[model samples]
Target: MAVPTVPRLGPQIGTRLMRRFSSCPRAYSYADTLPNLKIGAHTRVLFQGFTGRQATANVKESLEWGTKIVGGVKPGVEGEHLGLPIFPSVKVAQEKAKPDASAIYVPGNQTADAIEEAIEAEIPLVVAVAEHVPIHDILRIHSMLQTQSKTRLVGANCPGIISAIGKCRIGFQPLPCFAPGHVGIVAKSGTLSYETVASTTRAGLGQSLCISMGGDVLAGTNFVDALKVFEHDDDTQGIIIVGEIGGAAEMDAAEWIKDYRRRTTDPKPIMALIGGLEAPTGRVMGHAGAWTAPGEPDAQTKYRALEQAGVVMVNHPEKFGHGMRTLLARSLSKSGTSNTLFGNGLQKRGYHATRRTTLASIVGYQQKRSLYLKEAQALEILKLKSVPVAEGDIGSNGLICISIDRSALSPCIVASSDPESDPRLLRRIPFSYGQATVENHPMMADLADQLKIPSSSRDQLGSIVQALWEIFKEKEAFVLECQIGVSADGTFAAHGARFGFDDAAYRSSGRQEEIHRLRNTSEEVPEEVEAEKYGIVYVKLQGQGSIGTLVNGAGLAMNTVDALTFHGGHCANFLDTGGKATSETVKASFQIICSDPRVKAIFVNIFGGLTRCDMIAEGIILAFRDLHMQVPVVVRLRGTNEELGQQMIAESGLPLHAFDSFEDAAKKVISLAGPQ
Candidate 1:
């Protein structure tokens, strides 16, 4: 039965939307998922794929940690797996168990199907753990969700949620790392969520609820969705938002926080930690959605936004506990003393109020409307998203991305270029939807004075910004990098423009052939091209390195590289078999790593949530047996079927040494590599 939906909060988000990106944003709302996240002892939970190896393992752990596992769904399986009734479908299980929540532990490809089953059954809340879920599936699932608000999905690639006080743990987060307390946590990175919980728990603050929203590019439940729930919960007095780089979720959260502070009474303090600040722009991070895309805000942008929102910002994960604790106390102190500057409630930040938008924040706007692309959904994923490009993204980018040159003082328009790298630069100036046409404003003269652009190039900068903004607002674009040259002498050349349009928009565009004709495949990496054919992502590093990593999830892969680098080791390549990997694919990936002649050592780190551990172990063994391996392989396995995986490695007698901890395994690989 569909339950009554809570009206999504923060219509005030429109204030910011109007100022920046779009005139036509639908009432920006998502299901209030925090209520679902508020799992208590009485909240009966049902597991889909209950009898599967991964699900079974996680269910046991959840049960052991005090989760209310009333029943599960497993078609063709009779009886129960863990003293809980195992029905054939979510509907049957729902009827029997009367479950309020359902967790799907199916593989990545099947995650959407399982979620649909739960949704169709009217399951109020669904938590999915597959990391390799297709982006298209999430887009479809989200579309289905917007129609009505019966079902709320958490992760197709997350650890799930846990209520420290409720004693209801849905995901695979470390139990010891969490404790019942006053802080509510929401994050996209499962690994970081664990660290946040541990830090907060150690600080003696405990937690109200911890939500791993999954690091997929498009999350079913977002930062605002979770924050709205926490803002009202009595159990949650403060919030620790663990955000990752990439996309505008954090920035959006900052906006919502600013609006929420303006409206709410004595709002709880929020402390945030954004991960992968140093991650390469083009390379995908361990968390699937953690990397900075071409036009998305970087970690610093998000940090500044959150800081300006009165959120206590912590640069590292370990500071989560201390930071929130201090912020909460400080907030309390202010609340009691109204005479304090800015009163008791969180003060409005000058970030938005300041006329000078000095620093550059890579914000994206579209040429054509499709799904609400916040900060323009990553231009990289649009091809697979099926959102067609009305007009492609192209620009001439210099070595540095400068946010604003002196003329940035204007609220209506902003232009940027590196002062040191090149005085000549190209900029996208914002033009409003109504009344304020490009011709309406002669801001180019002001910008020219600020940028010291010679008289000859004033028209050049003015025309380009106007043209780009008009194109962006009218047709819509996903990503673009353009260059507007301005020399010391004021001469100008608009060269080096590259653009990519939303593929989902392309189907209706009837311009697919024309766009394809403008293709620039020459810049494509050959090894990456080959890996795509094999259904994997392979990005070889620039320099010859000794270690190669074969990991399951994007976040895990990036972290593995971080750990290796921290241990004075360099990774030869980033080879991800994706969320669901067969023995064939795993063996193939292993071969790819071994083929890298620079690889003196290989590290196999598999955190099997839905993906099985034994299968990965089998692939590693088979690869070594098939070809006498020249390098030592350090293996670390956890999660589903990990015990069997470890036993397999023990029996195989290959040079693969298995460890239970990431630190130990990383150290082993680094040591085995013996020097640079």
Candidate 2:
């Protein structure tokens, strides 16, 4: 088999995003890396879900690769093997032959149960090949393995691993594509890993271990977790990570590598390739974990972040070995260690070498530096106009620095640090200082940071605070009232009004008519229609309860809420965020509550299908922020840039909750307002 020398850009974003939506964080398990690429050809193995077509194909291929297949299990297919000895259960298979590991080919829905059964049988390792498993199933298996453990889980949708020269294979790949060697391969896709392994083999290099972690929203292990095993294994000299998109998992791994490299004298040379350039925008991909919701990590962005963190990026997968060899050459030269190049003269090929940093990066840096320079200049202009001053520093450290002058108090000016700045802060302050918005300033350095003004240049002073103060002094028209907030049920409540952060005597004046109505009726009987129309009733439930209802799109919503509760989150009521949603219908749906007082937090998951997110966003903003709804709402919007929807909430200046991950949004809402 040809060993892959370079890393391939594989399918990534959609899975990661799907994982985010599913609310499953990829588990980082370091112990899964086997001792060496040397798996004895005689090691016994079994198939857990052996009756399925995919499993049957993999079983045939695995046996072809020289794995000692002893038995199989398929519930009712007991005692009848598809081609091998078939047992009724994993226990029966285990009794017949002491297998070291077991491979699973169950459907996604039944994967966790299959893995759990394998674990119970004391199998050392389990490889799952089911794709699109539910998050709850992944988590259940993960939790079981973690707290009350047995076998290590490989994947529910992965290609499995190959021990190369040892000639033992567990996944679904042609074994002729790999040969044992020193380079370690860890990837998110089965096909991608095969490509890398194939390239390395062709280049005459061998693999220590080639692991194709599944691309589900929740993989059994993450890159960093797997790296720990590679680092400890004596055979691994260099490691290549093939990442795609969705979350910051790669970045998180890169950050870990930075710390790991700094701490260890003999850190392995690491290379990375991130894929997902042409990922579809609004649909969940093949893997449930591959969902790339809006604003979550994407492939290109992850690549850039990894590169900045000092990981060498290979532009072409075919050139991965070259990059690794180059880094190895540097490391070897730096250590003054004499080594011989073996297998093939692939490293000696006179291919064009590319520099990591290019002209585009330099130009981008210069642009940012210039923008910051202009901001400081503009701040100088504002100080001449009359704004108050509080000076702080960047501290040579990155933390924000600023000080507030005691005398610079106005009833309209609320401190930016105050969480509940009056919403009216918009009215008092101009949207822009010429071209800048309220987004600039805690002094002026904040403006530069917001504007992404470059920090490194003698000609560029980072003194944004001083310039802003100077500009404020000169600009009398830059009046800004504190940003606003109210109770969930629409009772007017300002931070300064309640907390008295500053002397409360200086709070912005004028209560709204709605606020007055709510405040007055807070003690008396409230007008039911008006209260129901404007305010959301919040109730907390604290008891052992099971069963949750989710209603929305035909199939998606059913799976979503069911999967959520199945994974341990208690779902009380699922209200469709769309489907002829009028203010009156919204009110009616909310009031009809056999579940309300008991329903934890309402998860309003809407993907804008036929319905525009802006309309929903607007409705939500009005119901909660302006009208003072009492319950915390968890909202997920897809199907549209939905930025317009986002912008509408931003303009209202209300603390409307929004998130790209349905899981993250659900978690946040549940934590804050779920049943007690």
Candidate 3:
């Protein structure tokens, strides 16, 4: 494999290198992209959890916005509700309503079942609003739909979709904020999705479909899937994808667009809003699974990939729609959509077409129409400035070849001609190129080998060194070896800091082989480093702080957190005991909290959804027994199992204080912290 020498973007001095890459390379302007398409007004919809608070609230709002919500599916409660018939099964709902799309509001564990049921009922579009669904559930649902039903599963954990002009608001999107139009909005985050929609609408362009694909770890469908749908949908003029930090989904989508642009004469314009430039890795905000875990994917890499593929980059979301319109208008002119006259037979009909053409020719009118081409040329200029390019070479295998600069070199060694290099030091450590790019260009691989580097060079030397540093420090290979084949993050890149498990025999057996196995199995090894770092256990009720935490019986947890924050408090963490709390789990939960230094005081608030509050109380008591406590503990026990829990806590005689009302308990905790 040949590695072509590429100029590094940021400068490096001695052993220190400056990596100043931003989130993603490109941003989108929503204001520039929206168009008015002829969309239908009737889009029949059904809701699965119509009885739930969230479902009812969202449905009522959707109904007010002209959504024809024909029916709903609720177990047992099957009378007329929300002015729609309620059924027990999706089949029953589908039969009565003949709905085109459905929205779901089931719990995480049962979300897969609900979605599968909807798919079985032949619902073309389904949106799930359940969070923290198991990863296996998402995979199974997507895989089953792909093979068995061919159903379009929108989200396993998402806010849902909305078609502004069509009046087809199938998801939980707030309709009042949306207007009708041609911009297609796809986002990973719900709030960001709404922001993009509002921005586009405010910019005088309506939306075709605003799809929030859920900001979960394992998503249902990717950007390419949504793009293809938009490409086929006549109402959709362009797509504005709102992405967040994490995953290679964006870059993969960009790569797909590159291929799509190559084949299609009339290509759908794509703009992107990839968020998370300031996001810190390992610290997952919002969704639990949406964390950017180490080297998987980030915004900067995605931006670069998208820019390479010719996606128009903008800065503000408000400008995205307008930007798209400008691109489209230019595209229209390039395709000769403007009125033109020909021959003397037309008689110039009170207008001189020849004179117009003559004037255009005199000052280069055709150049005004070639925006995309001009942009591509500008990119070429930037590319040349970033890298020293060489021409193609002949190969026996019909492969193209390009080599790096090797003006002065000795046999079996490449040397850097630096003034500071000593006579002896100059004889060793040859200079090498670590990065190259080739679109099925054969010369790249040959050039890589000549440069004494690998063929999978994705960026210039700075990036390559970064990847290498990460691999060395992290003791993990900088490569993603899929089942189909092997692909490196890049050749000659620095590695990430190693987890403790990387030092194990499994990793040492062969980094590449271990990575392949890990990728294939989707299994994670135990890293003592993380365990050691976050070993202490701490437990608290949903109370004041950021990162609102929750478990089963989300209503109770939510209420508790709400009350806590209402009293000038915030829930720093949410820990749900689910149905029942075990002593071991209680201890483990406490340890998790103790591991977090941000937690000052602890609140154990529970309103037993299924199991009694007494069990949770007992678990907390036992946790204090086994784990030595250093922080003040406040407990709020109510509903099912409260007596038994209180009895156990009292019997423990560990001086643990208890409370009933969440507010009172939060006040006590606030007081314990001593003012503010």
Candidate lDDT values, in order? 0.62, 0.48, 0.49
Superpose all Cα atoms of candidate 2 onto the true structure and report the RMSD in Å to 1 decimal: 23.9
In model 1, which runs have C-alpha deviations exceeding 4 angstroms?
A: 1-185, 190-208, 216-220, 224-242, 248-278, 286-288, 293-477, 484-494, 501-523
Top-scoring candidate (lDDT): 1
Q: Please write out the lDDT profile of model 1 over residues 592-628, one tens digit for every residue.
A: 7776788888888776655567887888788788877
When sorted by TM-score, best at the front, the candidate numbers are 1, 3, 2
Of the pair 2 and 3, which is ahead by TM-score?
3
The residue-by-residue lDDT of candidate 2 on 1-676, one tens digit each, is 1211111211221232223222322342224334322345656778887777767777777777677888778786666665678888887778887787788877666776788677667677788876545443453344345432346677777777667655677776556556778788888754445446655765666688777666655566567657777887777777888776454567678788878877988677777666543332323222334434212344556666666566666533445665566667777677521212222312111111232332112111121100112223333333443322222221121111111111111111222332222211211111111122222333244433432334442112223233332333222211111112223443221111110011000111221222222222343323222323432221122243322232233123433343354234565533332232445544444443223456545555554433466886776666554345555555555433456766665566554466655456656656655454
Q: Per-residue CA lDDT of candidate 3, range 1-676, in tens?
A: 3322222221211111112111112231211111211124666788888888878887887788778888889876678887778888888888877877778887776677787677667676677877656443453343344333234666665667777776767666655557778888887766556545756776777788777667665565567767766887877777788776555578778888889889988887777755543233333334434434322344455656776687765433444655666656666566421111112111112211122112112111121100112222322322333422222221111111111111111001212222122212222211222212222334323333433443344234323223332332233211110001112421222211121112111321333344333221112212212222332111233323532232322223333443454455555654544334566656766776566555667777654423456667767877887788877677766545556676676667675667654446667876664533
Better of 1 and 2 by TM-score: 1
Relative to the unseen true structure, what is the C-alpha lDDT of residue 322 in candidate 1, on a scale of 0 to 100? Answer: 64
**All models, RMSD in angstroms:** 11.4, 23.9, 21.3
Return the candidate ranking by lDDT, descending. 1, 3, 2
